[model samples]
Target: MPDRLDPKRQFLADLFDAAVAAADPRRILQDVLPPPPKGRTVVIGAGKGAAQLAQALEALWPHPCEGAVVTRYGYAAPCRHIRVLEAAHPVPDAAGIEAARVLQSCVADLGPDDQVIALICGGGSSLLPAPPEGLTLEDLQELNSALLASGAPISVMNDIRKQFSTVNGGRLAALAHPAPVLSLIVSDVPGDDPGAVASGPTVPGRPAASAVLAEVTARGLELPPRAMAFLQAAAEQAPAAPPPSRSTTRIIASAALSLDAAAQRARARGVNAWVLSDAIEGEAQEVALVHAALARQAQHSGFPHPAPLVLLSGGETTVTLRHKGRGGRNSAFALSLALALEGQAGITALAADTDGIDGSEDNAGAFVDGASAAAMRAAGVDPRRLLQGNDAYAAFDAVDDLFHTGPTGTNVNDFRAILLGELPDG
Candidate 1:
């Protein structure tokens, strides 16, 4: 007979697998495809999922189409007609600059007869870098570094980014105006705002330039002079044109959809699954504490759900990187959660990114159990010190509990699960 799998552990793993499946571009594309235009079709996108979306489009497209998409290095998809360009993400690089040039040039000459399909998801903000005039790539990079470390919400970050970009804020779609643009999106933001995804390369939203300035000043960020001037100029310009009239956008996948799928899988396995807010955000450590409180509530009061329940949540959380750590927000959340639990029996949790890369680390995230604290103590790893250093990767690595799932070829955000009560008897 096969070795028996722990029911609770198996349920959690299955839930994660289901969540990953829900974000697959191959599946998502099938549902959102518009009919092939009688005119020329051009595919352009940027994000961790761009290449995968490009590949899927190529596979499903019945007519001949051509274009290019940029994705992070090592995230390239196999394609023939559609060029897959690898670019830097979370930070723009030379590759992204060149890729942006290609993107701009692709639609520059298109007429009304041509159609553009923009496959946008997360990370497009950095990958589709087209710095405003008088600003070099370095200036943008410096500003991006500050923004990433600022712990600002995604909305604020994108608002600041729009002023300094050549292609963002619906400029890309504007470039191809008169050409019908269809955007198939895999939303990573809480509200599924298309304008926020990839900074609204295809969709447009008018967040005031003054708002960007206010946010930067409020955060006490010292932006490069050129960046500041760009924001000031944008504030003066008419609001970013509304999403192109020629553009029709559709959200094929989102974090909430994936979380719901996970909950369904848990129910099938005879476990009560409750979906917490799919828009949960904030400091990673603080979010863990909140989750820990929920776990405690379920254990003691059972207000949300009774014992033998699993709490599922999906959202992109941030970590103000104060320490020179070797982990991402998900791992940091897991480590902090383990500390808060303090070996309280009957709780097991896992936190991992849907894209299979958490923060800048290779591992997706980490897992923790009621005995995690004791295990760390026996291993001579100081959880508090690790948490202080933001070295959640090392802390979890020491106990061999880091969750590694490589690239899952999709991005919806973070998926977390906390299981309560004893494992079902075999």
Candidate 2:
């Protein structure tokens, strides 16, 4: 691990901190709040950042608000008027089942005069599970587990998830038909589509059940019989657009915004920074190889830009589990990057999730330099073997390079930065 005085690592960390700070609810939520409603203002949400988003709303909105929100365990933030509930993430639990009911109840029976404010963020698909009729939570849980290991993109997974859920696909907003709903979203998906985020509980639009089934089949996920039956029946029904509601969605934060913030911070420090893309998605290792190729281009030929530049990109990546590894897509990308950049000099990179939790692991992600692969070998660990085993966590840990930041009270998906050549002086 780099010491506290390591200028290169510190610079990269500063850029990441700036990106996360840009997405903090307290800092960005105040400006977009709607006017006080005529009737009751009920807040209901589900995600890793739902609690903090509720707390931010409470701090900003002077009008009395009452309701509940569900978040991942250990991510609850204090709220004065809104109730915060905790549940499992990446997989639904019984607590999530109950919380989903509570969320539905909050918006139920609301009149046109009332207002419903939904705080949606990443991890909500699992944090708020409402399986359709004839399907059990266990079925949903099993499907979720399989999807995570199937190496499918998040958008595809959510598309299929909407077919089997009672609350998603704008059903949550449909419940509060007469009431006006304002969905304040922190987008964690590629393209920042509000409907795609959290499976679009508040936003209306669902692919035909037939299309969803095709996606499921393409992914080769073996859902339970009841779950499969449910999809088939829905597909047999007449295709129709979801009922519209008085729902308006606004993306309060996203990977593009966060990447812009990081790039600005890098520029202020005199480093030439370029944001490659905020929606790069693919297999984790393959994405890392592309990034490595770009870095080498900048280092040797300066084709895209001169040396002393940091390449920034953000997007969710998927990993096909060849083994039961203890790492997320970000760590896998970092490990692959380490091997790809082996024997090169003066290249450093960081890949982590902005929400500060990756794949139920302790560290958000990992940091890799040109020498990271060699360092692992020095510690009696082969980087290639670990990568093949899908155990980047152990490889990075052996070199003391795992990045940890607990929970950052926000979610904007992946954050990655690669600096080639030498660090620029302030």
Candidate 3:
């Protein structure tokens, strides 16, 4: 906690804070809400940001709207009118199952005069899980564990989830038939597909079961037999009726918006901020290599941008999970970049999840600079072994570079910034 006061580290932390603040549900909820309807407004959602969105909506809306929202435990925000329920994330639990049931009931019997505002965001898939009739909570827990370990992208995982969920895949919206559903989403997946965010409980469109099964086989995931049968049966069955046409969705906050905000912050400070992309996605270490190459290019040629440059990107990266120890994609990317840089001067980088949780780990992510290598070696940390074991958290923690901020209340996926210092003239 003491070294967290370091000015250089604080600068990076400040940038991350700016990015997160930009995506706050309270900030985005205002000025975007539709006019008050004549009947009741039923609010419901599931995600890491759902509770915060509910609290913000309650504060912003002039009329009374009642409903329930589920969020990852410890991520709940205070709300007087809306009910805030906490549950497990990255995996489903009984609490989440019950919450999903309650959320579905919120939309039931709602008329066209009533409205439903769904606060959807990252982590909702696991936090709002509700399995089909034949599936038990234990079964869902197993499916979640395998899919997470298989290293499939979030979109793919969500598609598989939709296949077995009685509450996901627009089923919830279908239940709310006559009501007008406005899904306000905070996207954490690449391409910002609402149908994938939180498994699209209110948004329509689910990938074909055959496609998801193919992915499972390709990824070699150990799926439950019951789950497999469910998918096969669903695939062979005729497509269900279309989802509620009255339901509409809007992305209130996303990685792109967060990246833009970070770039703007850099520009305000006179630094040349170039946003590389807001949709970069892949294996964490592999993406680090690309980022390291860009940092090196800016350091050498300054092509596309000059010195005093900060390259920013926003997206969710994956970890293959070779080792059992605690580590997340952001930390993995930072460690890999440090090794690739080999303590090269005039460059520093920070990688963190804006939600303040990276994977199942406690820390958000970490920072790397010219001193990272030496610091690790001085601390008797084997960067190569740790990286090989997918234990970047250990490397960063050894060097006191682990960035921890508890839960930031909202999520917009990962935020990475690489600062390229000006080269000394010959």
RMSD of each: 2.5, 1.3, 2.2
In model 3, the Cα lDDT at residue 42 comes to 90
Candidate 1 regions exceeding 4 Å error are: 1-7, 222-226, 232-245
What is the alpha-carbon lDDT for the whole of candidate 1? 0.86
What tens digits encode model 2's per-residue C-alpha lDDT throughout 1-426? 445627887788888899999999999898998899889999999899999999999999999999999999999999988999999999899999999999999998999999999999999999888987678899999889878888889999899899878899899999998999999999999999899999999998889998888878876777667778888888899887677589999999999999999999988887888899999999999999999998988788876678788999999999999898789999999999999999889999999999998788988888889999999999999999999999999999998999888899999999999988787665
Cα-based lDDT for every prediction:
0.86, 0.91, 0.86
> Per-residue lDDT for 320 in model 1?
85
Tens digit per residue, CA lDDT, model 1, 268-339? 777788999898889999999999999998899987778789999988888887878889999989988998
- Residues 1-426 of candidate 3 have per-residue lDDT tens digits of 244455545666778988999898889999789899999999998988888889889989999889999999888888898999999988889899889878887888888899888889999889887878888898899889887777788888888999878878888888988888899999988899889888999898787777887888887777778888888787787777676648899998999998888888777776788899998888999999999998898879978878788899988888887678678899999999999988698888899999999888999999899779778989998888898898888999887888888898789899999988842332
RMSD of 1: 2.5
In model 2, which runs have C-alpha deviations exceeding 4 angstroms? Answer: 1-5, 219-221
- Candidate 2: C-alpha RMSD to true structure equals 1.3
Candidate 3 error regions (>4 Å) = 1-4, 422-426
Residue clash pairs of candidate 2: none
